[model samples]
Target: MLFPYLLKVSLLLGVLTLGYRWMVQFETYSKFNRLLLWLNVLAAWSLPLIPLPNWGPTRIQAEFHQSIPKIAQAAPAVKHKIAAYNPAPTVVSHQRLSSLNQKLKSLHVMQWLLVVYISGVLVLASHFFYQVGGLVWVLLRSPKEKSDRRVVFVRNLRSNSPYSFFQWIIVNPEKHQPGELQHIIAHETEHALQWHSLDLLLAELQRIVLWFNPFAWFHQKLVQANLEYLADRAVLDGGFERKQYQYSLLNAILCTTEVPLTTSFAQSLLKNRIKMMNKKPSHYLAWGKYALLLAVLYVSSAFVAPYTLTLVKLPPSILRPALKTLATNDKVNFKEVSSKILSLGPSKAESLIEELKKKTPETTKAIQPSRSKWVIKKNDALFWVISPLATLDDINEIRNEVKSFDAELNINSIEYDPLQSFIARITVHVNVKSGSSSTAKEGTDRYSPMKGESGYLTKSGSLGTGSVPNELEKQLQMDYEKALALSKKNEPYYFETRLMEKITALGSSSSHAFDKNTLNGAAAESAFRYDGVGKSTDNFLKLEPEHRNSELYLNSKPATFTELNSLSFDLVRSIKIIRDARGKKYMIVYTN
Candidate 1:
């Protein structure tokens, strides 16, 4: 609020100051102009003192000084530069660029904010004017007979009449003399004929908007005083003797009471009016003076020291979370993650993970696989990258190996059953692609020989080593090693123990069914998994921990596990035919 009010005041003051200097320079200065100058200065200075709608008077004052310096030494320097300008032919583009730069600097966000604030204040001021004017109108009504001719009544006391706008004559019948009624009637009639009501209303409204402006108030007072003086002169023009009219004026003031609508006609300021009436009228060179004033105002306002404000914009992704944390906790600190990533060297992947940690810590914690893999859940896509191992300990090591990259993973839904103190199902969506699409299928197909293509087995059955083509075997082995290395680095092998325990608990109750659909769906789900021999695995598990007859604790299934070893073997060979062309490839890995 203070910033806005100050903006308005500064703009108006800048205009008036320049106007005044111009008027003086042009030698068109007169007493009226001098009075106007003082009034404008008083008004401008008093603006800081007035209470603004949204801010205190003190705040408004402080903001004014902060936005605009009191002593504008820069104005002189700028004026000198403008005056001593030499146009260089070669630097026209540079000049244009400079102008654009200045314009951009001027139209700041803060300036717009100030504009909105002042506009509201202007609206409030207008309402105040209307309210006060309405009150005055209601207080000035008179109970008199309507007539075409306007009339004024001079009475010894004031009447609570509510006819402030129209012509009505009401006199103190108790104190009215024979001819005095006629005199008062004529004066009030003159006011009505001149439509002074509208003038008064306008003046009052202006006063309200510029309430802090002493000059504006003084201007209104002057206008009222002038109107009265003119009215008194009219009576003298009506063939009344000067001395007699003067006596009537004094007598009118002494006898007549102040009515709400009638401008005060009292002897209080009658001496001044009388003097003005007697003096010769002074001439004003209005055209020349007004033109000079206008020129000065425009020139001065244009050269006033402009304000510079700085604003920083945060990326939209970080905005909401940052604001929420700041609001809830009174502070938002992401320095730890940010500094860690900064120290590791700035990379797009590291920056994104760090940002996620800052926004959603809980979700971030659930997605951690390793320092190299990033789990990203955006919209419906859940993606995870398993990178090659840089160390042996990376295999099956899941606790804090990856700078806690869980922040990048989005948890869509969680279903918990408090009665059983267990989670029913955590529906996690993840995209798992090892190396590339071309290699992903081939790599997974390497284990297809162990369990065929049943869509439920974990490994492929073996094709006799001697029967296998040497080149194909080499490619399969290389792809296998790469996938295995990645799995070793990121897999949570311990997670199997916990998962097995939960499965056993559920199976013992018989309430949880081991349906084929559930098993197939669970097997198809991709996670960061590792084989016993320091390698990554992409096959899903079809576990029957309580198989009732099985000796094996768990049964693993490949993503493609529904075909016999022979058919699956043919399918794997066929898939490699166009693996690099298009479409998704599945890895069928089974390990017993």
Candidate 2:
């Protein structure tokens, strides 16, 4: 949110700064300068109201809902088990749980607050856009005659010259000036052709969206000045002399007629036009420099923007040294400290002393240190495994191979339920000894008879009946068949080799050493089935290839744990490899 807002501000500021520099260098003004200035101001004021989606709040909502199941499953199971054994736990343990609950509640409140803020900002932005749109529409519809022939006043003040939108021009046909009418027509035509009215309206709109930003106002001014420049170029291209053009511009500025929005000849700021006429065209290199400056400005704005507000709390132990250093400084007034200490009664003084002692170095050493280590007391540990087959029967041979390790290995659980029309997931839980557990990380190297020798080779292809036309369906079927054949020939071999490498690596890295002193009952709690993803059985089923065969899968395939194991050597080891800041790594082993 901050990034987008800053970008808008920088863009507006850059435009204004560049425009002012150009104006100073040119020593002249365009006909619509005053109107452009006013429009720019309006745009700046309305900028905050411009409608923009609040992606932050939306993302928070999604993440919260996704994590809810995991939290509910983990929290309740531990709470129940603890309560069953003892109605109330120690004060320390109870306090920790209470703190966790408070944190969760705070997170929920923050999520809602974000949602409300986003909603309000969006509503305000929409209203601002609507107001600007209305103003532009009214201006565009105003009554103005294009070419009026009256019987009265006809004065030839100057020759044909270019004028920006809403700039008034003096025309006299009675004097019979050469090409005077043609030049006037051409100048006005240029304004209409360039849609200068719409440009002004947009500039004004931008100003309103960023009214608080001075840069927004500047940007509008720059755009108006450019409009004038473009119009001048058009007039020059139409074969008007620079001297004659200057005279015409002067005459137009001298005329004091306010033209309607519908009228092409609307004279605005005459002084600025006179100044602009005397200036030379800008160089191309200036634009390149401006572009570079814009890039730097954007990067700086992004870097300086405030993002997260989560600050790490410094423990009192870390602050004690700093406090002691400050107290020792001669500049620190002893009188203030003496007065404050005297103000406290004997009882209060004792309480303060006690509080300080609790935060003191000796007290910190006596208190229990953070549990940063775990020990493998038992050889048996739980491990979650996923397989491509729907049932244990399909991988009975592979399971036997895994059990051949010297330690006792037990199958904790297995599931082969269809989640969707054709999709299904096969989840298996196994308990293995700490030493044997290392094999879980090793990539699978099993070769079944059903495995495709030619990888993902396909025998047939067809365009299933749907909304597609016959010709399009035929073309799609041909493409599908080609893809299937390629996959059949190449995919199986690639997956087999990759899986073998990963499994072997994991088996080699198995660790048996564990720190028993740091182990906590809470840390050993098992996560629920739906804790990670969700309780959407259909979603799980649809993810499997067997289930997907029933439907025309449109979305791209997601990489599963199996695929990740094959690709990343480090990831093949385990789901998590716990390590402390001191670089000591610990492997967790679960017992069923």
Give each model a TM-score: 0.31, 0.31
- Candidate 1 residue lDDT tens string, 1-592: 3654555655566566555544532232233543554455555545443322222232322234333432553456544344676777664568788998899788989887657656765885777656658544543663445555554432324542212344544455445455655565556666666665555655565555555555455655554665566566667677766776666567777644444324544525677677765765544654567666655543333223221110012222222353344333545444333333223321332344335434542233333232322223222212332222112232223213211323112223333222212222222222111100001111222111111000000011100001111222344355446545543432322233333455455443111122233223453243112111111133323222222222121123222222212132211211100011122121222222
Model 1 misplacement above 4 A: 1-142, 150-164, 255-262, 283-592
Per-residue lDDT of candidate 2, residues 1-592 (tens digit): 3434545555545553554454432433343343444443443333422321232232332233324544775784444344445566555668788998787777865577566656755675677667557534533544334444221111323423223343322344443245555655666666666567666666666555445556666665566556666576678867788777766655555553543222233255455554565556556554554455445433333222222111011212322332343254656443343234323532343244334423434222222221111100111211112223223442453344334333232333332212211102222222222111111111122222111100000011000001221232344345334434444444433443443355455454322321222121232222212112111232221112222212111112234433322332211211222323333333222111
Number of clashing residue pairs, candidate 1: 43
Give the lDDT of residue 228 in candidate 1.
Answer: 67
Please report, in order, the local distance difference test score of every candidate based on alpha carbons: 0.38, 0.37
